[model samples]
Target: MLLADPNNPTGTAVDLDALEQFAQALSPECLLILDQAYCDFADGERAGRGLGLAQRLPNVVVLRTFSKAYALAGMRIGWCAADPEILASLEAVALPFTLTALAQAAALAALDQEAALFAQVQTTVAQRRRVRQELLAMNFEVPPSEANFLWLPLGAGRLVSPSGARGPGSACAA
Candidate 1:
């Protein structure tokens, strides 16, 4: 099973306690992958839960990326945490030297500036809340979010393309 903690579009997250229970209930043979791509924008405890679960549960694997908070999307660098046995098996079949020297250096640099990056994340979270509040005041049904984007449910409403190319049922240009 694969699940994104802070799900896209909606930005809703499963409760950590509930997630732990669900993981415990699953069959031993079932492998659960928790994608925490946007976790840095979420609350600290919530963001770190996946890694804790991965460390404690043999069947759980947590995947994280530097693309969002670290602004390394172009570098395409990400990582996963799982049991040592599972990691060994993955390493056996994985391509060797997939990470370039430059990417490694960039990732290291990002790590070196972790405090500043996380401060930016906090700022973004505040902005997300402010934007959500504004949308709610405008009568848009914006649900509470823990990620970087807001999800406005426009039922039966026309969609607008980002490039201003109108498709069927589009309302306006970008």
Candidate 2:
């Protein structure tokens, strides 16, 4: 089973308790992959919950990326946390030297600047909240979001042209 903790588009995050319940309910043969790419934008405790689960549960693997909060998208670097045995099996089949030397160096440097990077994350979270609030006030049907972006469900509605004209057959058709 694969789940994004802070799901894309909607940005809703599953709490730790619910995640724990999911891990417990799954069969031992089933591997649960938690994609926490936007975790840094989420609440502090919730951010680390997937890693904790990966450490405690053999069948759980938590995947994180440097692309979003760390601002390292071009480097294409990410990591997975899972049982040692599972990691070893993955390492065995993995192609050698997939990461460029420069990318490795950048990832190391990013780790060294964790405090500043996470402070930026706080700024982003605040902005996300502000944007969501504004969208809500406009009656855009915005859902609660913990990630950097907001999802606006414009069901049956057509986007207005730059000239403020709604096309024929649009929901705004007169």
Per-candidate Cα lDDT values, in order, are 0.88, 0.88
- Candidate 1 lDDT by residue in tens digits, 50-134: 9998888999999999899999998989999999988998999999899888888899999999789979998999999999889
TM-score of each: 0.88, 0.87
Off by over 4 Å in 1: 156-174
Candidate 2 least-lDDT 10 residues? 165-174
Give the Cα error of residue 42 in candidate 1, in Å.
0.9
* Candidate 1, poorest ten consecutive residues by summed lDDT: 165-174
Give the C-alpha miss distance for residue 38 in model 1, angstroms.
Answer: 0.6
lDDT of 2 by residue, 1-174 (tens): 999989997899987798899898999989999999998888768876788888788999999999999899999999999999999999999999999999999999999998899789999999988888888788788888878888887768656765577776465555
What C-alpha RMSD separates each model from the true structure?
A: 4.0, 5.3
